[model samples]
Structure formats: structure tokens, C-alpha cells
Target chain A: MSDKGMNLTLKIWRQKDAQSQGKMETYQIADISEHMSFLEMLDVLNEQLISEGQEPVAFDHDCREGICGMCSLYINGEAHGPDRGVTTCQLHMRMFNDGDTIYIEPFRAKAFPVVKDLVVDRSAFDRIQHSGGFVSVNTSGNTQDANALPIPKDDADKAFDAATCIGCGACVATCKNASAMLYVSAKVSQFALLPQGKVEAKDRVMNMVKQMDLEGFGNCTNTGACEVECPKGISLDNIARMNREYLKAAIDK
Target chain B: MSVVSEDTFNSTSHFMGTNAVVQFVLQPILAFGVIFHLSMGIYLDTQNNKARSVKYAMNKPGTNSSWMSRNMKITGIMILLFLGLHFYDFWIPELNTKYIVGDMSGLNEHGGMRYFEELQHKFADPIWVILYVLSFVFLALHLLHGFQSAFQSVGFRHTKYTPIIQKLGNIYAIVVPLGFMFIAIFHYVSQL
Candidate 1:
């Protein structure tokens, strides 16, 4: 039952730039270990490429521990590879057959332009976060008592869940409209539930919506694809919350 | 005013002038005005139904009114009924005259139709006008909930942005329909 000496084929996308003509080049690897994480297999392949004086295929990975949110890859038509809820780094080679051909490609989005190969410039997400994502809390180490403001358990739980968004562009990549509503909503919800956020809530929604529109993100058709592909399973409820918040802001203004 | 020639000025003046009055104002108020509201209401209803099914499937069994889940279908249905009555009194007849009978009396010189005249004619009954105004009241209520809820459903209800969404909803609900109502009331009174 051990796959200590199995061969596999990798058909990876290769493009020089966003506008470059990209094609899938095939590579054959022999004697791969089933126990190797998907990324480790890539490391072994890279070693071989380097030994042959070939430029290793470029891909993004930082903190292979899966929390840094830097690893981005679409494997065989699934975001972050197969095995739901796990990022690409956590995927193991045991999931694949010995002679299977795995198709690997970069996450696609007009807003997320591809850099070299698997790497994409995800600064669009950063800009959206910068627009109106934070509360204007003074950083003077003014520690307020935690129990001074008692948020309902339900609200607190929802806030914590929304706050777990890691700013990965997977939602945007998976959405047919390329909508960032899920990401934006999570940011909005995180602040909205707390008393500290209520003071600037109105301006935040307005500014964020204006920024979202300005960023050329397609309108949300509510296909629910983003939720399905999201690594954290961020729900569509957050999108609903954002819509309500935006409407409230508009009326107040 | 100068004295008009007996041959030039005929008995048709009063009737022609009345027809002109009807064409300029009554037609569009009945036709497009009602159709616009009705179509919008129907569209909202469809969207609401979709949101309802989605929420129903997603919601846990014992959870209480979770804002967006509680309101989408109800608000959508209320808007649909509001627009239905609005159309029954105004749009149906106007459309009948404009399309089926090939009547252009309600239209203006710019080829744009005047709806106020038809509204006045219909609302002269008082019962129908009251019904029309009632529909608008419901429309206002529906918009009040819908505008804010749609954003929330889409995850726009952030701490910083939620208040803004609420404010915008209130304005849309109050201002747009109230403007239409003002015109409706003005025309109805002038006819009396």
C-alpha cells in the first residue's frame, strides 16, 4: 500500500507576463514518495530542474504552514488543489494516482494580474483592505478593559468568524464575476459588530463601496462560487451584511 | 384679447383643448409611471424569492431572525403587491390605449408620453387614487427594508459601512416614491 517509488506527470502553465502567450509544458518525475506534501514534491522536481541547468518553474509559497496565505495554485480545475478546506501546501501526493497527469495553473482574475508564472500581483486585495477596512483606534497602548464592552455571544462568534479572512485572492479568483464582496464584507463585519467601530461605520461603508467600484471588480451576481472555493468557508451571509451596511450608509448620508 | 373671427373660432376649441390637456398629462401618469413601479416590484420579488430559498436552506433550525434571512422574501412580496395595484389602476389602461388601440393622445410633442392626465382620470374615482397612494406607502416600506438588506446579504454590512447603507435605504424609500406621489396628488386635486 506504499507509494515510495511512483512516477507522475505535471502539466504546468508557463507565461512570461500577464499578456504573454502561455502554454502547458509537461514534466515527468520518477520515484515520488506518497508521504510528501504537494509542495515537497514540487521541491524535489525543482531540484531536478536545477541539476539539469533548467530554470525552475516559478510558484508562490511563504510560510508553507498554510497561515501566511501566500501559496496560490489551481490544480486540476480546483482552487488550492483538491481536498477541500486545505491549502495547496497541505495537499499530499497520496491523493493522486501513480501515473496521473496533474494540470497546474495560476489563479486567474483580471484584477489579479499574473506576475511570472504561478505568482500573481495580489495588491488589488491590499488596496481594498486599505480603503476603509480599519477602525481609527489610537495606537498609544491604551488598553481598554475587555469586559467593559460585552458583545452578545452570537455577535462575537460571527465577528470572530468574519475576522478569520486571510486576504487570499481565492474568492476573487473563483468568482465568475470576479467580485470581492465576500472579502469586503468580512472586513466590514469584523469592525461593525464592536462598539469601537460604530462611530466611523457610515464613512467606512461609503468609502469602501466607492473604492470597490473604482477598482473595476465586477458586480456581485451572487453565484456562491466564492464561498465554495474559499479556504476558510466564508459564507454568503457576510455579503448580505455588507449590502445592508452599504444601504444604511447611503440613506444616512 | 382681440375678437376672433366667427368662422376661425369653432365649437371644437373646448373639446380639442380638453383632449390636449388629457394627452399632455393623463396618459403617461397612467402608462409608464405604473409600469415602471410594477416591473421594479416584480423584479425585486423574484430576487427576494431566490434569496429566501437560499436563506431557508442555509439557516439552522433553531436560529432566530438573522436580519437578512428574516426579511428578504417578505419585503419582496410586499413590493410585488404594491406594484400590482399601482399597475391595475394606471399602466393596464394606458398600455391598452397606447399599444392595442394605437392611441397617442397621452403623448407629448417630444414623443414622450404624459402620464398625469391618465392618473387624474383614474384617480377621479377617489377609490382608485386612494388605492394607488396606498400601494406607494407599501412601496416605501418595502424599499426601506430592501435597500439595506440587499447590501447586508451581499456582505457589505461592515462596521464602518453599515450605517451608511441604512441611511441610503431610508432616503431612497422616502424621496423617490414621495416625489411621484406629490405629482399624483397635484394632478388629482387640479382635476377636482
Candidate 2:
């Protein structure tokens, strides 16, 4: 163990299948570097498991740059680890101390069934996006100059911010209802703000909401947890926009 | 022989008319009333949060309500579930047996009665009755916090209006659930 390193304990969730029982197994790692990312610490621990002839823990990770959003961990009852506006992969081990006990578990939701250990089926999100997350454009010659549309700066900035959503399931994982409104709203707002998407706006909101309900995902309670846990700091304003769009679309129908 | 048939026909027609009034006219109006008040309350609260955020200049971190209070999505989900079960137990079967399955000119599935028989039958099961009452309890909890919070969020925290709104919210929170509970218990005991 290095002089600057710390010893830590981990209680991780282990489950083989959806129908199988899950239990928390504890492991101890000594001399962990504070400068290492949280995922790197997990890698060191996995190496020990492999050398010890034990099966390694199953978890998801891709694009550790925080764009892919495949890495998700609930650390000490906080979603996406203890930090705000940072994903599990981005969280550093320096946030903790020596001899600290960390409870690591996969995001729990009925809609997001656990596929392996830490991996959950977030295809429900993909389904919601498919419902109405795109602008309806036929491949044809550009009709107007980009600046000719003249979108207000405020609206453009809001749209760009909403577009920053990485389609991560962190919002759903942290939400008490497992609601996807924040993510869905971001997708809806991204298009609804631009003139190119105005033509299909009505159909978009209606179909998306209908699909959301049908997916067995819970409705938005407006608790703002999704916004809080979002790594990109997606605002709840997009949800408000979604509500307004849903109302108008519903009334028109 | 002719008198008996005429009497049956009159009774059947009367029941059918009342069922139509309750199912189509009354229930929908009540549902819409709930939706309107609740949506307005939510919108007002949202606006209030926005104004408060601007006033504070920076985000207010970890200064909100408890998990349950913060998460109204869970409550909305429960309400939606109850609505589905309620519609299934009462509206669907009523519409099906009375208008669809059985002839409108004759006695419906549960005899020549509408509210009394159907309500009683649905509430007869102890589990069903318990579930309905529990759902109302959840609704009351949600409304109590939501109503007051909504008013306060919309800048209604005045000396006079605040108390009045709080009182009204309390009354509303209690009365609505109690009324529904009364109906559920009434039907359940009637079966016994």
C-alpha cells in the first residue's frame, strides 16, 4: 500500500437473472489511489476477482468521456454517484476517504429490468425517442438560408441546451416514478424550438406522450430529481414546454 | 300478462336512462373538474419556482421538500392507476353489459338496477374495497401538500388569502377523499 493511498470496502449488488434473488457481496481494496477515476478502481477490484478465480461483477460502460452515458451507479443512495452533474464514470475516488464503506447498486425500476448485474434494459428510452424525437425532413435541396429563419437567441440557446441531453437513463434511474419526462421533454423541445420541426409539432407531442404512457413507464411528478441528477444540467423548463405542447396537442385533437 | 311486461319495460328504461346520465355525463364532468384544478395548481407552482429561482440569482440546492413531497410523479402514477381500475370496475362493465352485451330495452346484466347493484357487486370483495379506500388515502395525502404548495408557489402567501387558501385546501383535501370513501364504504357494507 502506498503512503498516500487508502483502504476501502464495497458492498455491491450481485444478481444472475431477473427472476433470481440478489444479494450484496462485500469486498475490500487497499492502497487505492485518490487520483483514480471511480471506474478505474472498479477495474482494479475486477482484476483481483479474476485472479482469485471468482466471476467478475457485470456492469455497463462505454465512452468514459461521459457522452455515451452507459455507466450508471447508485452510490450511498445518490444517483450517478455522490456528485451532482457528473456521471459514475466521471466520479473520482478522491471523493471518498480511507476505510469508507460504499454501497453500489444498479438503478432499480420495473420498466428498466436488470439485464445482468449493473446493466439495465434502457431500450424503453429508445422507444420514447422513436415516437417523435425527429424533424420531418425529406432529402431535398435546402429551401432557405440557415439565418433566414431568425430564431430568438433565447429560444436558440434553450434548444441547444436541451439538445445536449445524452439520452442517458440517469434521469429515470433517479426519478421516484421512473418517469422519462425530462429526457422526452428535452428531445421534444430540441425540435419544437426550431422552425423546421413546427410542422409536425402537434403530432410529435401527442404520439410521444401516448407512447410514454403505453410503455409502462410512470408519469412525471415534477420532483426535479431528473434535472438534479442530469450530468448535462438539463433544466426542468423543458418539462414545462412538454406539458404546454401536450396540452395544445391534446386540445386540438 | 300484458301488465307485467309493461311494468318490466318501464323499470328497464328508467334504469338505462339513469346509468347513461351517471356514466357519460356525471363521471366525465367530475374527472374533468379534478384534472382542471390539478393542472392549474401544477402550472401555478411551476411559475412560482421560476420566479423564485430568478430572485435567488443562483440555484437553490437541497432546499426542497422531502423525497415524497418532491416526487409528485409517484402520486400522479398512483392516481392514474386508480383511475384505470375504477373505470374498469364501474364504467367498462356497465357500458359493456348495459349497452353492448345486453339489450337496452331489457334488464341489464345485474338485474333491473344500475348504481346499487353494480356498486355493491364491485365493492363486495374485501380486497377491492380495501384497495379503493387506500387509493383515496393516497389521493388525500397528495392533495393536502399539493394544494397548499400550489397556492404558495403562485405568490398567494398573503396574510388574508394564505390562511383562506390553506383552510380551503384542508377542507378540500379532507372532503373529496371522505366523500369517495363514504361511497366506497356505503356500497361495501350494503353488500354485507
Candidate 3:
């Protein structure tokens, strides 16, 4: 009590597997230092559970500094806890108060199903990327030199902004309709803005959008929730760009 | 103004009843537009619901998006309900008189042009006027998000123009509903 260690309650989703039902289970922890990251707090809870001969909570994390986009959670109804522009791993224990009850659950979408306690199968994102999220690179000794084509500074910066999206399902998880338009648009705009990407932009947008829809993601109603919950600060402008790109491609075809 | 001004109301009503373009072309087009918008809204909402079949245990939607954007379904359904009452009040009776009853005279029993009187009578009752005013409020709520959203849906965002479109959308949402509410209130108050 003299050390000022925080006492907290954690309510975590517990699911045996994808087919089994899940429920929120609560755990109480004491003496948690405020300096630890949110993941570290969960680590302490998991260690305690193991020592008590109980199964530990299962969650996903990698590159705890927040670049990999591997960690995804719906904390207390938010995509990555209460903080803005930070992933769950980047979230700190200082954000929570002593005796606070924290709720953690996996991101929910028809396209993202639970794999374990807080691990949902986000491979749907991968399939959408596979559809056309890349540029056709020439590697047969005929590749054009980099910067051969001049890109407008504004376009380059915007493309870089769109390029920062880590493919995390936060946008999808946060959207009411579970729309992936922001994510798909970011992928589309990254290339659409650049000369290299513009060559095949027509097919890229069309195929990627088709794949996105086939994965059972909802259509965008332009609520713009995805931008607010995005850890990378992705803009709603990307979704608008994607909509325009899709329309242009549809018309041209 | 039109409701209180009998001359303006009757001539407009008479022109509307007798004009082939208004009766055939405009009315059908308006009806189709309503049906398309209503059915599409319902279909999209149903699909949106299916996207997340499992409900969140403890989540807050208000932190991220506007209330109007989040609750389009509620506002849209309210507008639909009002449309039903509107059809019952005006359209059904108008159609009955013009078609089923075989009268296209657009005149009252005393032949003084019934359009103004009929419109006035609807507002004479506080309940009907209140219903109309309330419906206009819902219409404003629906358009607040919808006006700008349609442009986004169509991929029409320009750095210079998007802001203007958003501003225009807000103005349109406010002005259109306010105008309708004004008509309802003006009629009701003038009679009083």
C-alpha cells in the first residue's frame, strides 16, 4: 500500500475455440506499476493465472512498439482502448485508474471470427490484399529506374500518408457496418497517387474491391468511424478516394 | 403563404389536377424515387446488420462517429412512417377524388376551389400539424449525414470542394426541413 501500486480488475473474453461460445471472465490484480504498457499488464495477469494452475488468457501481440499491426482488441468498446493514434501494445497502464475495471475482447466482424480468447482470424484482410494490392514490378533487367517519373510533392505526401496503414482491423472493428473501405482505399490510394501504381490502378481497384466485398465486409455508409479508431491516424479521405476509384474503374470497364 | 392565400392555392391545385405532365410524369417519377430510396435504405441496413451478427458486450459507438450517421436507420424509418401518414392524409384522398371518384374538377362542394380549404383543414387540427412538423425534423436528421454522404459514396471528394459540399449539405439539411415546418406552422397559426 505504501508503494502506490495500482489495483485493477480485468474482464477478458474467454473462448475455447472458433466454434465454442465465449464469455467475459473477470480477474483482479494488485500492485501493478503504472509504467508498464497495457500488454505488460496483461502479461502480469497471465503469469498470475499460470501460477494459480489456471489457463492463461490468449491474445495476440508482436513488435510491442506498435509497427506490426499484429495486436488487435476492442477494449471497452474501442478499437485500441481509449487512446488515440496508438495500438493496444502502445497503450500504457497509466491510462487506467486504480480499481478500474478493464474490458478486453477480440475485434468482431463477420469477416473476422474468433480464433481463441482474443485472437480473431483476420486472414480475410490478407485475401483482400491478394486480390490486387500491389504493383507489377519489372525484374527482367528492364526495370525502370526509381524516380524516373516525377511525382507531385502533394501527391507523394498523401500517398505516404495512405501507405502508413498497417492493415490492422481497427478500421473494420470500429466501423458499425464492419466496412473495410478505409483499409482498401489506403491500399488503393498508395498506388493510385504514385506513377508506378497508376499503370494498373484500374484493375487494382476493381479486383481489390471485389475481393473485399466477397470477404463479407459491409458497405461503407461514410460514418467515418474507421478513421477515428485507426492507430496510424489514417484519414477518411482514403475511403472517398477508394469510392471514386471504384466508380471510375467500373465506368471505364 | 400558399395555404392562406386561396387564389394562389386554388390555381396551383387546379393546374396540378388538370396538367398531364404533373399527373403522369412528375407523380410517377416522385413515387419511383421514394420507393427506390426506401427499399435501398432497408436493403443496405439489413446487409450492414449481417456484417456483424454478434453484438459487442460493452462498446461505445458515440466516441467515433456522429449520432446522425450511426442512427440513419432510425431516422430513415421515422421518415417512412411519416410518409405513410402523409399518403393517408393527402395522396390517398387526392387519388380517390381524381381517379376512383371520377372527379378532376379540383373544386370544393361549393365550387370555390377546395385546395386551400383542404390544406387549411389539415393544419387546423394541431395533431396533424404537429405530425408534419415532427416529420420535417426527422427529415432534417436524415439529410444531415445523407447529403454529404452521397457525394462520398460517389467518389466526389475534392480538397477544395469537399468542404463546400459539406457546408452546402448542412445548409440544405437545415433549410429544406425548416421550410416545410414553416408551411405547416404558418397554416396552423394563420387559421388561429
DockQ of each: 0.09, 0.04, 0.81
Q: Output the better candidate (2/3) by DockQ.
A: 3
Error of 3 at A158 (Å): 1.1
Off by over 4 Å in 1: B1-192
**Using Cα atoms with residue i matched to residue i, what is each candidate's TM-score against the true structure?**
0.60, 0.62, 0.97
lDDT of each residue in B1-192, candidate 2, tens digit only: 112354554566456455768668986898899789668646744533332110111122243225445645567668878989978876576567656876454454556644444445677888988898988888887887788766533323454576787689889998999888877787678668
lDDT of 1 by residue, A1-253 (tens): 6856679999887778777867778899999988898899889988999999987888899888767788888777766766667778888888888888888877776566778777877887788778889888777899686788888998889888998888776776655446678888889988888788888888887888777766656555454667777788887778887777887898889
Q: Residue A24 deviation, candidate 1, in Å?
A: 2.1
Query: For residues B19-74, could you state the per-residue lDDT of candidate 3 as single tens digits?
Result: 99998999899999989988988888888899998888889999999999998888
Instruction: DockQ for candidate 2, please give it.
Output: 0.04
lDDT of 2 at B144: 72
What is the DockQ score of candidate 1, to 2 decimals? 0.09
Candidates ranked, most accurate by TM-score first? 3, 2, 1
Which residue pairs does candidate 3 place in steric collision?
A77-B59
lDDT of 2 at A195: 88
- Chain A TM-score relative to the true structure, per candidate: 0.93, 0.95, 0.97
Interface RMSD of 2: 13.5
Q: Single out the weakest 10-residue window by summed lDDT for candidate 1 chain A.
A: A216-225
